[model samples]
Target: MVGSLVNSSLVGCDFSSSPTSRKPIVLAHGARRGDVVALSSIEALPTLAAFGEWLRKPGPWVGGFDFPFGLPRELVEHLGWPLEWQACMAHYAGLSRDEIREIFRAFCDGRPAGGKFAHRAFDRRAGSSPSMKWVNPPVAWMLHAAVPLLLAAGVDLPGLRPGDPARVALEAYPGLLARELIGRRSYKSDDRARQTPDRLIARKDLLARLETGQTRLALRLKLTHPQRDALVDDASGDRIDAVLCLVQAAWAEREGPPGWGLPPDLDPLEGWIVSA
Candidate 1:
């Protein structure tokens, strides 16, 4: 554990490349004290500009961002993008969304039906959507919108890039942790009509497990009554997903930096998710 990071600010962001008021980028801000991570507040950034501004805030903080920091190395190689991390990101950021979709679509067109998308080494372990996937989740666009801001903000991404060590950034996927607590249980839905009682019950059960520190992280979630209720009531699950990321951030902080509990041999072109 890094002594300097004890009780330091921690953030977990559930991001959207194209954010709007209805489905804004949600941030769960908290800190770890001993084995408990206390929820301080939840914030929503309704635009990419707001999210960019938030990234530039002074740090000595660690953030677990729910976005892909890098694309699959296989995809990068196939498209002949820069092999180096920084250069690859620079080239990727230079292209428009349309261009990205066109190129990715062509790439998929060349592959077989079932294995159309190239995956990063950690994708299977984390159970996350492929970073190259531009639809459904649109994580590819999320990567496009986010990595440039992180680069501009000078945050350190362990095992990938080096910058401001105080402002540590790690790729996070809430599904990894959520699956540990509730296997294949759907706890949320964006559509109001689909927010069924069973889903709400699942959310409550998930929260119960988290509060009891039942997951492998073994860190209890400290939430006020209202905070607890808000997580359960948010049918979209964005808020709870952010909190799930917050817990991952806390675990990474406890493990300290450089690897941050990720495998030391992680691909520089496809960063591993923390705690995956």
Candidate 2:
């Protein structure tokens, strides 16, 4: 906590590429009351259109969104893309997914085994997936799909774009918070059958830690019994991730005047993850 967050609402979103009912985007909504940050509601957006509409809604909110904000500078420069953020994004959006894959694959092919993916500075600090990783997490595609919408929505992304100051958006990674709570413990699995007892226990422990104010962000989380159960019961981890991001948003709201908790030395081209 760096400042008074007496007047802001918080949101955390766990995003998916092709969101369906089975894999909808989870949006966790929360607000601070005294020392406790209470999770008030959750919204599921089943389509990109729905998500776009939700984002454009008026608000004085600080949202922590789980997606890479920019490509690795090395990758961008190597491909001779424009250095300007908006221009680079425009160029990126114009390319087909297959074209992106081919370009990234060629870049990886010449690199060493452990260095196949180029990383942003914030990724190094936060232990985030490489923004260029197209498969596995497919953050590259997520960035491609989400950034344009964010731009269109005109929400302010600190160090990236200037939009509506009231609706502030920050890059957030729930894994960073999860790792702090339980190092290398697997708390989620997309496979239905693999959602085991151990992961459930981990989720419980994480929720406990959050409620007790055990992280760098010094605010306690307040959840109703049903809200706690809902977060634990969903073994896919999207719900918990959204909550984690919501807490991160709360942290950001109090972290600084206008940087959204990002470091002052942050790279303009490579956005910083909130609370990283």
Candidate 3:
């Protein structure tokens, strides 16, 4: 927002609800000096509290975080929840996980077979799961857990909020970039047994494309040899997902606009995904 506010630092977060040492939240921090975007570090926040503190730290950063910032407007309205984003989130925060699941289940039960999940406008474009879905991906819970923290952190969410221009948070989906490089290819798995050679190869190819600037974003990723190995060796793909978001964060910095590549008619209550 100022001449001094050049793109200096960026971050990508692969978040988790109840992160432990085994499945910690991965944070990728990068800095852009000229054209090269260097991954300065990858840190793990083993608890939700730790991640919250990290986000609140002073920054002239544009972070692309891998979490849904809002629920579907359709779901919120149908459930008689608040239409305003802040009020809807406050209402959501008061409910337990079980309560959320039961309410969402009832909404789905009343819908037709193929239309069970109500989607935000950006969901289809970004190839993301419905924001109300509580299981499988549990992105519903991610929103339940993450948005409150974002609000508490008071970072600007572009079209969504005006908290801190110095600390900008954009909703990012790594699958969008990964899918762009390798369609429907599974590159990571939680189960050790499922981490196959082919998936590893896909990760390598994906990273290669990123470094070579194969994306429409026209930004090449710069990672050290150790950083490259760390990204590929982690079979969970959390590290790689964080890097994907880092690239998105860098792109957001370059866009330098009101919405930063989000849809012009983007719903304020249901925020759009960056680079969708």
Candidate 4:
């Protein structure tokens, strides 16, 4: 079980070359709770080893980390990569960027029928998962970045045993909420100029929905103006990703605390839950 004292936290991370480590910096919202002003830390990484240490300590957190945790097995298998997780990771780690691209390109070529060569879900509607075979969701990358550290730190997933529960991580898809509120019209923005008033209005409306727990997942959360603005200010939607994590954390708290329904032997590196 997680401690009675729970932290409602959201962390938005831009991933780096070292999968398990974080860089390009990490921005944590709600780390201290009580309505936050800005993300806690953001910085470039000098080394993967250092980034690994930082990833685990980013908080007392029930976080929504913005990243994909699973890859389409089709793509992996097609690449003639190892079927097993460990072997696949080793293969991936050893390859250069060009090798990965060439391999991925070949796999995508002459792909299967069924409008599903790449997997991505823009909308959260029923069976909306686009496909799993995407190389970029880099769910494989997500796994490489996360799971090992959690296992070493003694965190457990849904399938784990009691002795193995400490930290908790969930694969949270921010697009879940984005798609829910705005459908598939591209709510993600990186250009400050693109942070148009229309998008801000959309985010405001979305926040209202989250506050009311107005969706299938039944998540109710409170957000201060500062929190709301912080999200709105981030043109890249990173802040909103953290907010999505906040909603997930809120729902998880309602069910139990840190250690509820988590699986054993689940990959910490690869985490997934509702897109929201």
Report the lDDT tens digits of candidate 4 across residue range 44-120. Answer: 44455565676556344544445544444556656676766545555666766556656656665666666435543
Q: Distance (Å) between predicted and true CA of 202, model 2?
A: 0.7
Clashes of each: 0, 0, 0, 18
For every candidate structure, what is the RMSD over all alpha carbons to the true structure, in angstroms?
1.1, 1.4, 1.6, 5.7
Candidate 2 least-lDDT 10 residues = 1-10
Error at 110, model 4, angstroms: 2.9
**Ten consecutive residues with minimal summed lDDT in candidate 4?**
120-129
Misplaced by over 4 Å in model 2 are 1-6
Alpha-carbon error at 164 in model 4, in Å? Answer: 5.5
Q: What TM-score fits each model?
A: 0.97, 0.97, 0.96, 0.67
Q: Supply the TM-score for candidate 4.
A: 0.67
What alpha-carbon RMSD in Å does predicted model 2 have with respect to the real structure? 1.4
Best by TM-score: 1
TM-score of decoy 1: 0.97
lDDT of 2: 0.89
Off by over 4 Å in 1: 1-6
Off by over 4 Å in 3: 1-4
Among all candidates shown, the one with the greatest lDDT? 1
| Tens-digit lDDT track of model 3 for 62-170 | 8899989888999988989989888888999889999999999999999999999999987998899998998889998998889899999998887677788888899
